[model samples]
Target chain A: MIHFDQVSKRYQSGHEALRNVSFRLAAGEMAFLTGHSGAGKTTLLRLVALVERASRGQVLIGGQNLNRLAHRKIPYFRRNIGLVFQDHRLLPERTVFDNVALPLVIAGARHQEIARRVRAALDKVGLLGKERLHPLTLSGGEQQRVGIARAVVNKPPILLADEPTGNLDPELSREIMGLFGSFSNFGVTVLIATHDIELIQRMNTRTLVLSKGCLVDD
Target chain B: MRAKATTPHFERGPRFQLRAWLLRHLQTLFSALGELTRSPLGTAMTAGVIGIALALPAGLYVFLDNVQAVGQNWDGKVEISLFLKDQIDDEAASRFALSLHKRSELRHVQLITRAEALEEYRQLSGFAEALNAFEQENPLPALVLVEPTLRYAQPEAIKGLVAELGRLPAVELAQFDLEWLQRLHAIIHTLKRGVVVLAALLALGVLLIVGNTIRLGIENRRAEIEIIQLVGATDAFIRRPFLYTGFCFGLLGALMAWLLVEGGLWLVRGPLAELASLYQANFLLASLGLRASLVLCLMGALLGLAGSWLAVRRHLRGIEVG
Candidate 1:
């Protein structure tokens, strides 16, 4: 569903963050993006998310070239793509239900549908009872689960996770990865960027590795 | 299958209605409002600052308005006084008054004969016995009290007419009681300019107050905003809550200022009424009227909105989501 054709990104400080990186993920595919610290993994995902424009190459999502899309239209494009961070990124002041329902809210879903979908998403992540609780009240693993629930709540076709398990212990990381794997089985395209080699081996997913601002392996 | 059927129907309805877009984003707006309400003390403090800043100029404005209303009543009392030569008799003064009555500039003219003037002066001065002791004659001149037409009541026009009357053979001197009016007009004009400058300076103060508040709010929410952006939230979406916070502060401030000004007016109303009674006048201190109040509210809102917009536009650009 996403294609990066030799995409390159450069900062104004003369640092080339991504140099001629190219990759493609088929529809409903699950993949892991492995890279060390200061690697171009985040930049690659950001390009697909259309947060940063490729300096000299095309980044395509769902057959639309993101580099050519108008800035005002970016939000509309983002409505179909879900992003999760290592920190979970749930609004600290809001309840789990509200955070999970945010994307649907942004998409202008009906209130009843939002309630229903948020409940179902929370249920799927084993957070059904914590709907009204704030993120700070939840454990790190539970918070990440809430993040995952939020990411998939809008039923976005593509889900991107950057270091979703970085802050978790081995057991919690396994649980989060299993949750992602379950989402893939539901036909949601999943791409996770992580540095955990052991976890990557256990997941048995397609792996793309990057080093020093360049994609070294796929 | 039921879920699929419901989904398409739900999806179709939103596609046709533009209001759905706003309704869909209501959560974001409500979330923003919730954040503002979360810290009631901080919110109240910021709003109080805005209110004080706005009330200073608004109170001065009301004062200027009251002054103008009182001044308007006295504008009609302006008139010119013609003093005839000491040798000029009552008959000549009466003829001169009659001549002046024919002029378009003269609204009404009354001839005060020298003997009648001396008799009135004796009555007013409590000098009846002293005047009788003088024996020969009172040296007071025959006077003409001339009320000018409203159109010719202005200082320049009255001055021109007075100069013309001064040149008349029977006239010794001509004076208009416009000196006080002229002084009042000059003072009001200067006060208006001063109020404008003061309002401008106070407006800047309000901007800075609101700007600083928003800046602090942004700093507090910096991490959350970075995370929001990382999760594909646009700058507009991230900035929405702060803008709403600023607007709320401004709106609350306006309400407080309105109360402050009204309270001040109420406190002084009784004394002002007594002062008016002393002058034997029915003067009412004017309050901030509907239009002025509306303007004040709108100004407060704009100040808040503009201040937040500036703060967000400047600061948000520097934040990069990792």
Candidate 2:
């Protein structure tokens, strides 16, 4: 559901983060974007998320060209996509339930709908009973699950995760990958940017690799 | 034996849904409030600082208002006194009074003949024995008390009128009671300038105080904001809570200042009344009116909103999520 055509992003200081990157992911497909540090993986995902514009080419999500979207319309465009970060990114002062409910809140769902959806999402991540607990009180795996629940709470069609399992153990990482695989089964397109070769091999999804500022292979 | 339950369908119009969309973002408002509540002490301190800064100028404004009120009450009574020549007789003085009465500049003119003035003064002053001890006729001239029209009560106008009156053959000396009015006008002018300078300096102080507080807030919440942006939250969404926080601070500060000013006026009202009583005059201290209060509150809110907006616009750009 994402297409990047000859995408390039260059910083103001003349450093190129992404160089003529081209990729396409089909609907409901899951992919692992593998790269080292400063390898343009994050830059590519950022382009898809429309947080940063492509410097040279078109980045399309669904059928809409992000480069052509007005700045005021960016928020509406983002509602169809969900993003999870490696750090969980939970507001530490809030409960797990509230953290998971953030996307719905942003989407302006009804209170009852928020409570119902948040509970269900937390249940899917095996975090139902822990909703009242704060993020600081949860383990890294639990916190990551909370972040994942938050990402999918609005039932976004496309889910992007940046190093989702970066801090988890091997077992926890596998479980997280399995969770993403389940999301794919539910027809949600998922692109996970990671450097975990073992996890990628185990999941055996489509793999896109990047080196320096260019996409080397897919 | 139970039948499968069907999901109920409720369809809302697109416009209604759009409104709902806006309503859903109330979380941003709540989150903003929550952030402020997280550090009640800091919020209170910041608001208190703003309140005191605003109160200084507001207090001065109130004081100047009272001064203006007192000046206005005295302005109505301003008049001129004309002393006739010692040789001028009653008929001549009476004729001069009739001429003065014909002039549109004077509101009222009363001719006080020398004998009548002496007898009236003697009866009122309770000094009949001193007047009787005088062997010769008293030297008090025919006094003409002339009340000027409001427009003619000004220093220049009164001076001009006095000169005109002095040229009259029946007059010996003509004096316009304009010195005190001149001094009062000068004082009022100086007060207005002082208010402007003091208000400007205090407003600057308020801006700095609010700016620094907002800066601190940005620093404290930098991480959380980065996370929000990374998760596809727009800059407007991220900036909204800070703006509300600043508004709350300003609003609360203004309210506190209003209270302080009213309290100060209340505390001094009794003494002011007692002092007025000693002077055998009725005086009322003025309080801040509704319009002034609203202006103060609006000022506080705008200051806070602007300060926060500046802080957020400057600091948020430097924080990159990707």
Candidate 3:
């Protein structure tokens, strides 16, 4: 579950990114965050992930307040939330399997357990046969799939994606959305932030639209 | 069921966590080694600097040990000679020697009467013909040679014993070369202290070397560190590989230092033996033995760990999750 109550983020240079945004997504729910380039969709996702703490009010995930979390506990806190970026963020030097296994490794899983989960996650993303191949050698869509596989490999309860299909073809975008849908069906909460209005319309899920620094519509 | 089966399994229990912790450390240990091997030349150069620094003090320590052993050997050969007054005759000197022999501090006492002294002087001295002029008087004084027990054979104890013996009514003088022996002891003591100071400075240098190397390693892997941090890798996990890198540098550097010390000692052994033979003394150069070498390696590893810890603490805070 994810909840934001009057959350606002202001940069050090006095630029306000988000202002008094409020939303709540129940467990196993899937939603889309839609806005233009400077509308704070990324900032919202960052607040939920605790990458950048909300400058005002509260951002909560699974009943834990992001504002009051101690600095040392941030890593453990992030473990329960999976994040994907527009650029895929796959380590180019590592094999596809190693990229997916990162989250499980961070969780200190056993070697055999990691291998098994990584293969299964790769299978979910339709990348099972490309496990040994490096990300640079893979196509753009395939690399994005690897990133999605990595984000879910550890089976985090909540998933956050920032324009994960921004660079993919429309067909690949639909497939990635389908993966998120199936994950939500299995009782995992999923939130996607994107600027592609057409894709958001096609998603047809609970959508929150941001304009300027305000949550204009939900 | 298929979705449920893939749900993350949290391995609980302290024993299981500890085992996993150890397994992760083992993995990092080898991975760090692999990282170093990937940049062989750079690693060797850094380790070589550490080795030379370590070897300097280690060599000096071994040298000091050898010198102290030789000094102890000479300490065993101390002898005090007591010259009797003119009033002390042969029978009186022999009685004095007997009394001195009974003292706990004296190991042995031998009395040489005036007649025996004159005879020894006549046979050894080339002035035997000239000494015949004083044959009637036989002016040589009676002497008692005193050898101190091992405990009292040192310069300080010998000085005290000499002073006590000089107070004897029949003894004209109690003499030993205490000044030269004291000088030798002073030199060795000063050199030992100097070696300790040098060792400490060089150890600090080793720490700096390891720290700098680890700093560079952290800098090169900045992206990887940031990404891992974002993916829920703890600071400990991010720090593990760098610490291991420093450890490898220290361990390998210590091994290098050991080889340098052994080689240096080996090169000097033959020449040192020849020099000892020229002085009519048998001496052997002592190398850093197995125990000492192992200790050196351990010190290296510890220094490496400390250096990397310092570097990581200072630099790791600069990198945060994006």
Return the top candidate by lDDT. 3
State in Å the error of residue A25, model 1. 1.8
Which numbered prediction scores highest in TM-score against the true structure? 3
lDDT of 1 at B96: 85
**For residue B24, what is the lDDT in candidate 1?**
35
TM-score of each: 0.83, 0.84, 0.87
Deviation in Å, model 2, residue A136 alpha carbon: 0.9
Candidate 3 at B84: error in angstroms?
A: 9.7
Worst lDDT window (10 residues) for model 2 chain B? B1-10
Clashes of 1: 0
Better of 2 and 3 by lDDT: 3
lDDT of candidate 3 over B1-322, digit per residue (tens): 0222222356689999999989999999999999889989998999999999999988888888888888777677888889999998888888888888789999989898999999998876768999999868988899998899988886677789999999999899998877876788899899989988998999999989999888888898888887788788888889889989899999999999999999999999999999988776789888898888989999988888898999999999898767
lDDT of 3 at B204: 94
Point out where model 2 deviates above 4 Å.
A6-21, A35-39, A55-57, A70-72, A212-217, B1-34, B83-104, B110-144, B164-172
Model 2 Cα lDDT, one tens digit per residue, B1-322: 0111111111277886777757744655676678778889988888888899889888888888888888888787876789999888999889989989999998999889999888887877778888888748785788999998988887678788899988888888998767877798799889889988987887777777877888888888888887666555667777888888888788888998998899999999999999997776799999988988999999998988888888888888787765
Candidate rank order under TM-score:
3, 2, 1
Better of 1 and 3 by DockQ: 3
Judge candidate 1 against the unseen true structure and give its global Cα lDDT, from 0 to 1.
0.82
Encode model 1's per-residue lDDT on B1-322: one tens digit a residue.
0111022123565354566766635655676678778888988888888888889889998998888777788786766778899877777788889999999988999889988888998877778888897669777888998888988887688788889989999899888666777788789889989989988888788778888889988888888787666545666777878887777678878888988899999999999999988766898988998999999899998888888888988888787765
Expressed as tens digits, the lDDT of each residue in A1-218 for candidate 1 is 88988888998888888988888988778899998987988888888877789998898887888878998666667767779888788889789998898777655567788999999999999999999899999999999999998888877778899999999999999989998888777777889999999999987889999998888999
Judge candidate 2 at residue A29 and give its lDDT: 86
